[model samples]
Target: MKKVILLSMVTLAMISCNKETQAVEKVKTAYIDTSKLLEENNEAKDIEEKYKVKSEEMGRELRAEASRFQNEAASFQQNAMAKGQAWAQAKGAELQKREQELGMKQQAMLQTLQQESGKEMDSLVKRIKDYVKDYGKKNGYDYIYGTGDAATVLYAKEAYDITTTISKELNDKYKGSEKKEEAPKEEAKK
Candidate 1:
């Protein structure tokens, strides 16, 4: 009876160990190249283009204002001697005030652009993270790591890299959304 009990316990232990090993092997994992994902994602590209256009427009406006200020300064320099010391002093003070105001506007514009861009980028990153989380859940991925810049994974097999797959999916989703948005505008026009 003692021999039979001991043999039974040994077999049960082996069976449990085999099941645990199989469970570990069944876990699915993947890694995404963070930089590549952003580079390839259509929405990210659109955001970049949108900001670029905004920056250029703001730059042109600022440049035009600066050019006007420059013209005024040039005019003052040409007429300062004829205008007399008191007039020159007053005009010089006024120009200095204008320059300071221009400087403040430039600084404020830069700060606002940076803040807006940062907020949009942060939101985009959050969306990407949520998408990845949902993707993992749907696809039965036990873990998904990020690799690039601030990499979370040091090395992974090429087979395990899902950057391209995710990028393509994201691009397709973005295109679908663009079409949907355009459809509404088209209807509005009709």
Candidate 2:
């Protein structure tokens, strides 16, 4: 009887340990190809398009200013020969000043466009990260790694990639919000 009781207790302890081991939950992990996500996302595409249009507009403005400056310089050159030396010297200085001003304006416009584009891109990245965090939490993911230019994940199975899934969800959310925004405008018109 003592031998049987002792054996039973040991068996019970082993079973308990086995049960605890079996109860351990697996860690759910996924990876996103951040470059793919950005490339595929509609909002990101729109932002790129917006910046492209703005850059083109700014480029046209700069070209127009440059054309005006060239015309003015040409006019000064024609009149410089007929005008006295002193007048020519002063006009030359004025033209030089205008050229410098145009260069500065071009630099300023480029910097402004770059700054604006950077800000928008940064904001979009933040939104994507927040969305991923929320998605991971909702979907019971323990970790979501990113693989891109500066890849955090060097190697992951294709099955573990959540980039396409996240992109689709993000684009859907963006489309829904766009509809909501348009609805408000439509109502305002009425």
Candidate 3:
């Protein structure tokens, strides 16, 4: 009787463990390309495009100022050399201070834009996470991972890539939004 009871318990335990392992194997694992997602994400893309256009305009204005300064620099250099070494030393230090101030201002503006862009990127990441939630629910993914930053995942199996599918779906969704926005404008123009 003791031998039979022991055999029964071991059999039950083995059966339960086997079922648990099979359940685990049925789960789908997925890896996401986060860089591609952020780059092609609609909200992030829009912010990036706006930043590019604005920054280009700012750069042109800065370049024009640079040309003006370069022309004036020749005069400053000539005048300073004619004066004593002390005068040149003082002028050079003043010019350097002004340049440093301008550099700091540029740095501030860049930091502001970056902060704004990063916020938008954060929003996009949230959207992707929400999408992944819905996707996991619908398609039965066990684990979906973002592999862009701070990830230990070096390489995932080829079957585990969810980038292209997500990109296509998100791109289509963005196009749908564009159509909705443009519809009223077209009607007004017509």
Candidate 4:
């Protein structure tokens, strides 16, 4: 009977301890400030702008290339038609085939360059993720969240928003660093 009583006490203690552990576990909520993150990682914005510019340039280049190729192809068409009468028709077919092979190589190179830009974008995204994780941990955030197109942050408990605190720290540190760097310049002007 005493052993049974002792076993019950031990079971109760274990249950209480588990309850205590659950109670102590920190409740975490997190949200992403995409604008803030984009601002923080200026590289992302730069990449986007540069991507737009390069894409426009590529478009222009392709347009010009297409025109040039069209003119050449037209010339070949005439030559082939004439050569068909002047020589073996098989030779004209061979020339047109060669042009197609060259066109494919050009297309492949453009695709590769486009893929390279995507890689740069992916790298920037990874850096932003690292920054957010660091910011969350440093600021005692138990949970972090991502803000998407339809913001679900409509009404979060005020306590969940550690963003202002994190933002202030980031801004203040940046300003401080800038001030330090500019101090010597101002002193020189004086």
TM-score of each: 0.87, 0.84, 0.76, 0.55
Ranking by lDDT: 1, 2, 3, 4
Q: lDDT: which is higher, 1 or 2?
A: 1
Question: Candidate 1's residue-wise lDDT over 118-147, tens digit each?
Answer: 888899899999999999999999999999
- Give residue 136's error in model 1 in angstroms: 0.3
What are the per-residue Cα lDDT tens digits for candidate 3 across 42-144? 7677878988887778777767766666666676799986898998888788777767766776777778778887887778778878987898778888888
Highest lDDT against the true fold, candidate: 1
Ordering by TM-score: 1, 2, 3, 4
The parts of candidate 4 lying over 4 Å away from their true place are 1-28, 33-41, 58-61, 77-95, 147-190
lDDT per model, in order? 0.95, 0.92, 0.81, 0.69
Error of 1 at 149 (Å): 1.8
Q: Candidate 2, which ten residues in sequence have the lowest lDDT sum?
A: 19-28
Give Cα distance to truth, residue 77, candidate 4, Å: 4.3
Give the per-residue lDDT of model 2 (tens digit) for 31-121. Answer: 9999999999898899889989999998998899899989989998899889979999998999899899999998998899889989999
Clashes of each: 0, 0, 0, 4
Superposed by TM-score, candidate 4 places the C-alpha of residue 52 at a distance from the truth, in angstroms, of 3.1
Pairs that collide, model 4: 30-144, 30-145, 31-145, 32-145
